[model samples]
Target: MRTSFSQYIRFQKRLLILYAAIMVFISIMLYVEPTMSIHFSNLLYIHAVALIFLMAYLTIDYYTIAKHHKELSSRWSNGMFIQDGIGAAKTYEQQLYLEMLQSVNDAHQQQLTSILQDKKESMEFMTTWFHDIKTPIAISRLILEQAKENPDNESILEEISRIERSVNQALYFTRTDHFARDYFISRTELDTIVKSVVKQFAKEFIRRKIKVDLHIQPVVVETDSKWIVYSLSEFVSNALKYSNDGGTITFISEEDSGEVRLSIKDEGIGIPQQDIRRVFQLGFTGTNGRVNRKSTGMGLYIAKKILDKVGHRVTISSKEKLYTIVTVHFRKGDDYYSIVK
Candidate 1:
């Protein structure tokens, strides 16, 4: 209300000055007219009546002129947009402003839509390319397997596996945004998924001479089996990457109070305390990455994203140079299918 009054006062200040000036001229004329019969008391009475009438006119004009200003002020204070709850424009300038704002909004929306469409097309192409490239990678691996067992063949096979992992990572990264369309939720066996992931990395295990201590019970979870397998493979790959020759990687599962926890603990060069907090951040190669020199830093980040979308929780705990344990928690009663829907 105070703001509206101030606007009203500013809008009419020029007219108010003109009115005061006319009244002053009238008073001067009445004073200087010696031949006139008007007395000083009569002049004072006339001036008082004129002042009352002027105040009445100002009150009506204030309400008439400041009505729109008051409405706009109320909307702004309440955190509403200019187009919200504001009725038809009372002036040409206001109408022009509204039309201009609407045009700009429309243009912005079109530009944003174009950008998203381009990104979707790019991801679709990349996903197709990844799939196409995997055919040749598989052929290469098969050809290498058929050859004699030698150190060179083994190294070539390892490099091929590395390429395959990289391609799969890129494919999954693209699919992350389109997860709603790609994933299906069902009652999946947790142990089966873990074994499959381990099988996928069996060569890596053998090459590193790392022992797998699987203690998983026959636990089941409601999640997308494909995504869960990929996520677990990422963790297992990380374990194999950092584990020393003849070291142990333990996989344990336990259920308590309707919650199931699956842990992958590795005896490796553990994460530094300062780097642990940022390990899951995208493209953040921490102290361990510096030591290994092969970390793309997307494995844990992608795993966490997939787990969260599946309504599962993942936590990591580590002691420097001792052990790093990554745990995935699943609640038996959660409606994970709702997330897919």
Candidate 2:
């Protein structure tokens, strides 16, 4: 049990009262002067001086205790306390205090463990749900493919494709936290990764009539091909999403100073300055998001996470209504890119 300030005050007050009673008794004895000698009078004066010093010490001690009461309570709760004086708590009280502190620490540890277990279970469930949902999405896409000959059916197919992309994005995002252990890094051709990612958005590029300027060389880099492809696709998709129809989108990759730089530049409505800092933050769809309500805000966030794991860096530079450039920097000897290079 914790001791209160009032209880401590009462204890100090008792000490003061006992000291005062002893002084009063000494004064009465002195007044009686029943055949006392000069030596005895000197001894009484010495005793009074000592009592005054004791009272001064007690006053300072009380003030210090009052000032630090709250701090002492917190320390006690956390299994730390200061004990002084010969008549302090005995062995039994000390043991009880230690036991109480250990119990509190054990409870705190159990609570943290329980929270972590719940989070692990939740992530596992999401991963399983995403995998299960992909089957129906595939079936719908197949049905749409077979019926694509009709113009009215084309819209349904487009919508289905969009839904498929969303589901895949969600699956990838959910799985990225575990991607580090599963990733395979090797030397991959820069052009090959670019071509694969571009192919996925071939239909969107065609539909928007966006001009593509590809300046990629047959350069090689060490990196995770799958994550690199996904990262590049996210940038291109963002470019396509923000750019007006007929706007130009440029995909450029080159090796410079032992580093590979790949950039996606779009002549579109660029991002605002305030939104640029928060673009890669999860669930942050900024000014562009307000205009394009279809943006899920997870694309850049996922890309950033995946790239960082693989030792690649992604950056964005934008001028509102003028242009936006998303750049991915690749260093040499990264497990994924090094094998490919």
- Backbone clashes for every candidate come to 0, 14
Off by over 4 Å in 1: 1-87
lDDT of each residue in 135-232, candidate 1, tens digit only: 99999999989986665998998899999999998899888887898888888888888889889978878887889999989978877889989998
Q: Which digits, one per residue and each the tens of the lDDT, describe model 2 over residues 285-307? A: 99889877967789999889888
TM-score of each: 0.80, 0.72
After best superposition, candidate 1 residue 327: deviation in angstroms? Answer: 0.9
Identify the candidate with maximal TM-score: 1
Worst 10 residues of 2 by lDDT: 82-91
RMSD of 1: 4.4
